[model samples]
Target: MGTTGGLADDRALLGRTSTAERVADILRTRIAEGYFPPGTRLSEENIGGALGVSRNTLREAFRLLTHERLLVHELNRGVFVRVLTVDDVVDLYRTRRLVECAVVHGLGGPPFALDGLAGAVAEGERHARDGDWKGVSTANIHFHSELVALAGSERTDELMRGVLAELRLAFHVVDDPRALHEPYLARNREILDALRAGERTKSEQLLADYLDDSRTQLVEAYARRVADDGETPH
Candidate 1:
């Protein structure tokens, strides 16, 4: 992400928070949006100066993200975005399956808001129409964010935001973005359609299958990269 103007933009995104909190919020969003891709070093001077924060305050922010598993600290190489391993990928999907599938499974017995999920589906369709695969990828993040929101708990939403942020780290390594994201647009539609039609069982099954297929695809892609680098994929 551009080290400049992030604080102001992120303040708007975060509204009112402590200085260190604002810094972490901005950095977290930047990392999630693929602004700070995996392994990109965060320049303390550049970021601290750009945000007009003291080094100590900025360091505190960095520490927050590091704790979130979004940033990694090296002895002398400074802080960089965390590069997820295959084990990380598997765990991420496991979390997704537990959270999102539960939301789908719980749909029938109670009433909840579907606006977030529908809105994200529409956003994805809109972006896909314009051949904006990256835009679609961003929309896909929101789609899952919306799915988690269906659980109707702010705590779950908060937990999932971090989960998706880590998932994006895996997404960043895709050799072909369209190949990675395009095939899923219709699948999302099917899941949404099943939910809309009140087929809770079908919806849950679709999501479970979606999670399994996606996990496999991402693991294969990541493994290929690691193998190319002469390191065994985890």
Candidate 2:
């Protein structure tokens, strides 16, 4: 009887872990795919019941996503998907440029891995061709993240992850991703080419300009969205 109970407990624990991860992925996907939309409330009871998970497990998943900036917690209102403003876009890009440009210039040689960055760019292009705008957005983020990681700074990589999450949220507000991302493909390729050729300075400059243009376009998109909805985004 004791052995059977122990096995049952283990299974229950494993199930809980799986459920929590599922919740996180589902929420993340919704946010990424813009299904929940920015500033939309997420009720623990409603979501948990719908997903057939307990409230406690759902709360844990929410906490994880909140830490990632994909969700925001309100005092009494509950959690909601984050909404980014023009200011937020500018701030994120400012930090990104500072960190990423420095990383590109500081690297002595080709980083440990280039395949991941190349893969991300290729995936982004494929997603673009397929009209999977969100997938393309995600792949574009991964490409820059891998570029930052080339500097060999774990802390910078972590910071970039948070910034990218917020940026992804901003992307959800913008309807035309091709207008947002298509122009950057060649720039990304140029940066990679410079890196391969050992021209760190040129690569850094190109990345800086890319970040600037991205910020401008996202801010314009945010403004347009806000105007259309007549609601201020924050």
The best candidate in terms of lDDT: 1
| lDDT digits (tens) for residues 1-234 of candidate 2 | 665776755776787777888899888877776788898999888898889889889998998898787888889878988887677888989989888988877788754367777888888889888988767777888899999988778899889877877788888787788888888877777887777777888888888888888888889888898789886553
lDDT of 1 by residue, 147-232 (tens): 88887789989999889988998888776778888888899889888777777888889989998999999899987886686642
lDDT of 2 at 35: 81
Off by over 4 Å in 2: 1-22, 110-112
Clashes of 1: 1
Q: Could you give me the TM-score of model 1 versus the true structure?
A: 0.88
For model 1, the local distance difference test gives 0.85
lDDT for 90 in candidate 1 is 97
Candidate 2 structure lDDT: 0.82
CA lDDT of every candidate: 0.85, 0.82
The candidate maximizing TM-score is 1
In model 2, which residue pairs have backbone atoms overlapping below 3 Å? none
